[model samples]
Every structure is written in C-alpha cells, then in structure tokens.
Target: MEPTTLTTDRLLLRPFEAKDVDAVHAACQDPEILRWIPVPEPYGREDAEEFVLRAAPGGWREDTMYSFGAFTKSGVLVGSMGLVRLAGLGGLERQAELGFWTAKEQRGRGYTVEAGRAVSDWAFTALGVERLEWVAEVGNEGSRAVAQRLGFVMEGIQRARIVQRGIRRDARIAALLPTDWERTMETPYLPARTD
Candidate 1:
C-alpha cells in the first residue's frame, strides 16, 4: 500500500519526509513523549532520519503499517499518528492498532483527536478495517483520554501487555469497531450470560 495523506480542518496527516527529521527528533525529546511512547530515551538525529527515510516508507511498502506526521495547516509538525500491526488483510479478520504522540507544546488542544478521527475514517472506509485497537500503558491518562474521545470502548487492562525501555507494563486496551464508527448496530451484540 502506498503512503497516503489525510487532512482535517486544522491539520494535515502525511508521510514523513527527509525535511521532517529535525522536527521529529525535537518532538521526541519531550520526556513525556519518551515515557509514554516506545521511543528511544535519548532520541537522536540518526533515529529521526531512519524513521522518515526507512521505517515509515518500509511499513507502507510492506502494507503492515501506515504512519503519518500530523502538521498544522501552516506546516508545523504537531504530532505523529499511525495504524500499526495491520492484520487480516486477506482474511475474515480485519484490524489494526492505533498509536500516536503529540508534541509537548501541542497538548491540551484537540488536534490529535481530530487527526485520529480522520485516520480512523480512512482506515474504515479506504482500507476496509473492521476493528481499530488502542493500547497504552495503564497510567497514561492523556493517551487514554484521546482514545476515549475517539469513541474507543475501554475493554480492560492486560497484564504485561507492553514492554518499554526494558520493563514490562500493564496496558489499557480499547477498541472501536465498524458499528461504533456509525453508532449503529452492524450485527446484534449480546454479552455472555453471567448468571
């Protein structure tokens, strides 16, 4: 799958370019971003270059992930968001994991949420994704908040679901299904009887 671009009223979601390396490296410097996301502790220019020059393009070519750099309309890098670990493309199950991090100065605004919605819409419609999952370290309230605002139903916490910086951590898992996208029932859902 070729890398594509998405846009919201206030942002543009596009593929990373060589010119974005500096900005990407700078954003990854935020301790909060490093702590929550699985980026290197001391992110460097080389790491940034590799991401924009290799990983981002490789993922798209492999059809395993689709990453985007979120920028303000004026072209200032604001965040990064993507659908990773794409699965079941040729089978009955169709899903992907959503991940993102906002620049330190861009927090508290709704840009990330807006970009997430646009990406989700594209995943559901353009990519035929049936399930979009979001997982974050259990205590990362900001990430959880964005997922919640995007209508991902909090499923529960999974033990040792993530490993970051050499330590295993429990993660909060959530999902937004096709039905959830439209706020309508695709197939009737019934929970198991606990009685």
Candidate 2:
C-alpha cells in the first residue's frame, strides 16, 4: 500500500519527512517518553535520521506497518502513531496492533487521541482490519488512557508479552472493533457473553 495522508480538524497525519527529524529527535529526549517508548537510550540525531529516512518508509513499502507522524495545522510535531500487522491482513485474516507516543509538551491536549481515531478508522475501513489491539507495558497510564478514549475495551494483562530494553514484561491489552464505533464490517463479530 502506498503511503497516505490523513487530515483532522486541527492536524495533518502523514509519513515522517526529512524536516521532521529534528522534532522527532527532540521529542525522544523527554524522560517520560524515553521511559515507556522503546526508543534508543540517549537518542541521537543519526538515529532519528535513520528512522525517518529509512525504517519508516521501509515499513510502508513492506505493507507491514503503517505509521504516521501527527503534526498541528501550523506544523508543530505532536507525535507518532502506527499499526503493525499482527496476523492476517495479508491473505484472509484481519488483525493489527496499534501503537503511539505523544511528545512531552503535546500531552494532555488530546492530539494523540484525535490522530488515533483517524488512524483506527482507516485501518478498519481501508485495511479491513477486524481487530485493532493496543498493548502498552503495564502501568503506562497515559497510553492506556488514550486507547480507552478511542473506545478500545480494556481486555487484561498479558504475562511477559512485551520485551522492552531487552527484558520481558507484562502488558495491558485492549482492543477496538468496528462495532465499537457503529461501523459495520463484512466480518461479523460474536464476542463472548459477559455472563
């Protein structure tokens, strides 16, 4: 799939470009972002360059990960969002993992939530994604909050399911189905009964 763009009322969601390297590099410097996100410790400009100029586009070309850099209307870098194909989506299955990181200064303003909604919509409708899962290392409250606001039902903790900084850790998992947003899809979902 070719790289695409999404526009919200206040932001432009698109692939990271050369000009965005500085902002991405700077944002990764925040202790909070570094603590949770699996970015390089002591992130360097070269690392940012490799991510923007190479790995990001590579994901698009491979049709495995769809990533977007969220920016304000005036072009301030807000954050990054992505969907990694977990299963299916290649032949007959439809599942993906949703991930994101909000810049330190851009937190609490609802930008990541806005971008997440748009991205999720595209994944469900455009990519035919049946299950969009959000997994954050346990205790990442900020990330979990954004997923909830986007209507991802909290599922539960996954034991030793996440590897961060070379160690396995538990994760909080959640998901959003098309029906959560009243969007009808070809694949019918019969969720297990609460009782």
Candidate 3:
C-alpha cells in the first residue's frame, strides 16, 4: 500500500510531507482537537515531525494504515484522515477503520466529508474493503456528524471501546458498506428480515 494522493472538487488528500510539520503542530494545539483527537496533550514540533516523517510513511509501507492530509486546492491544511486497522484486504472480510480530525478554523466547510467519500470509494475499489467503520468516543458530535454525512449506518455504541490518555471511554460505532455506496460486491450481502 504505497502512499498516494486523492483529489476532490476542492481538496487534495495526500501523504504528509516535511513542510507540514509546523501546520500539523499548530492545528493540534487547538483545545477541541486535543480533546477529541487522541493526539498528545502538549503536541510539539518533534511530534509533528515524527508523524510527517515517520509514522504516516511507515503505515503505508507496512500496509497497516493509509493516512492522508487533506488540503485545499490552494494548499491550506484543512484536516487529516486515515484508514487504520486494515484487515483482510486480500480476503472476503476486508475492512478498515476510518479516523479524522479537522482544523478548528476549517470545521464547517464539508472538507472532511468530501475527503471521506474519496477514501471510502478507494477502499471499496482498490483495497477491496467490504466494510469501513468509523468509531468516535461518545460525545464527539462533530465526528458523528461527519460519519453520518458520509453515509455510515449507526450501528450503536461500544462500552469502554477506547482508551484516551489511559482513561476508558465509550464509543459510538458506525459502518459504511459497499452497498451503502451502491457498489456491487462479489459476495452479496443478505440482511436479516424484520418480522
């Protein structure tokens, strides 16, 4: 899974580069981003360097996660989105977990949703992903809103599903299937009938 770029009407989702360190560090300083995003509380320049130089690239090289930094056409960093925990991409149960965080100033412009659609479509086609899941710690209305807008069906909640700063927290779970996007799957899904 080599790092690649995905484009939208207004965005260019690409792998993080060395120049993104400052912007990434600055964005993570937002209180809201720190609260909901699981980034280090006191995110520093070194951390940003690690992400841009190491972690993100390493994920792609290992085929474990695919991360993209969402930017405007004019090159403004708007957010970060990634598909982690890629499992069974070579098998029938292929799946991945979607995660993202928007810059505080760029919150309402629908960039995240646009980027999500691009990633989801890629996963379904290029990666053969059957299901894409989005999980947010409970109370993250913003994330939930984006997930809903991306057409992920609300599957319910998971108790103690995530640990943030070592504290257990409940999480809202949702999924987007190939059928949700009108993409045909090799193995058809049969939903249970409600009596």
Candidate 4:
C-alpha cells in the first residue's frame, strides 16, 4: 500500500522521504521526544534515515503502518503522525493505532491536533477504517490534549501497557469511531490556513 497524503487547514500530511533525514533526526533528538518515544537516547542521523527509508516503507508494504510527515503551508517539517498495527482481531481490517509527535518548536501550535484530525478523517473516509485508537503514556499531557481536542473519548487507563526504553509505563486509552466523528460537529479543530 502506498502512503497517502492528507491535508488540514494548515498542514500537509504526507509521507516521509529520504531527504527528510536531517529534520527527522532533529525532531527525534529533542529531549521530550526521546523521553516519550522508544528511540535511542541520542537519536542519530542513521536512525532517522533508516526509519524514513526502511521501517516506514516496509510497514506500508506489510499493511501494518502509515506514517506521514506533517508540514506547514510553507513546507516546514513540523512533525510526524501515523497509524500503527492496522489490522483486525478476526481478519477484519477495520481498526488502527494512532500516534503522533511534533518538533519542540512546533508544540502548543495545534499542529498535531490538526494533522491528527486530518489523519483520522482520511483513515475513516479514504481507508475505510471503522475505529481509530490512541494510547499515550500516563503523563503525556500534550498527547492527551491533542486526543481530546480531536474528539477522542478517553476510555480508561491501562496499567503498564507501554514498554518504552525498557521501562514499563502506564497508558491512557482513547478512541474515536467513524460514527463518533460524524455525530460531533464542533470538535475544536483549527481551520487550515491556505496562505
């Protein structure tokens, strides 16, 4: 499956390219990013290249993941977002796991929320997914805020669901079904900027 491009009011959510290594490395190097994600303590350019090159494309081929580079209108690499483990429990591919991260400088700008909403919209409408699930570490307040802003209902907390960097961590689970999106009209999402 080819990675698809999605758009929101101010974001161009597209697939990562080989040339994105530097920006990806920079994004992954942020202390907050390394703290939350299961990346090496000091993310190197090789890791970024391998992720954008090997892991990303392989996941697409296996129908396991869909990652997108979040860009602003002026083509700035502000972040990344994706769906992982996009398969069903009983051979029905209707569910997926959602994850996202933004550059340090891009935080508090609603970019992830906007891009995540766009990804959710595309997953439901274009990919025909029935539900999108989100899980973040218990203390990941930023991610939680984005999930809430995108209208995901917090289901509950799962004790030690995430094993990040060899450490067990609790997670908060949230979900959004297609019907839920259709029913909610005002989800507090930012309008995409066209300029």
lDDT per residue as tens, model 2, 63-116: 878889999999999999989855788556789999999998999999999999
Model 3: lDDT to the true structure? 0.93
Candidate 3 differs from the real structure by a C-alpha RMSD in angstroms, to one decimal, of: 0.9
Question: Which candidate wins on lDDT?
Answer: 3
Give all TM-scores, in the order shown.
0.94, 0.96, 0.98, 0.89
Give model 2's TM-score versus the native structure: 0.96
Candidate 2 residue pairs in backbone clash: 89-93
lDDT per residue for candidate 4 within 1-195, as digits (tens), equals 877888788988888988888999988989999988877778988899889998888887778788899999898899989999787623454788899889999998888988988888888777777768999999999889999999899999999999998889999999887777664321233546979
Where does the lowest 10-residue lDDT sum fall in candidate 4?
182-191
lDDT at residue 173 of model 2 (Cα atoms): 92
Please identify model 1 stretches exceeding 4 Å from their true place.
183-195
Highest TM-score: which candidate?
3
TM-score of 3: 0.98
Runs in model 4 lying further than 4 Å from the true structure? 89-93, 183-195
* Cα lDDT listed for each candidate: 0.91, 0.91, 0.93, 0.85
Better by TM-score, candidate 2 or 1: 2
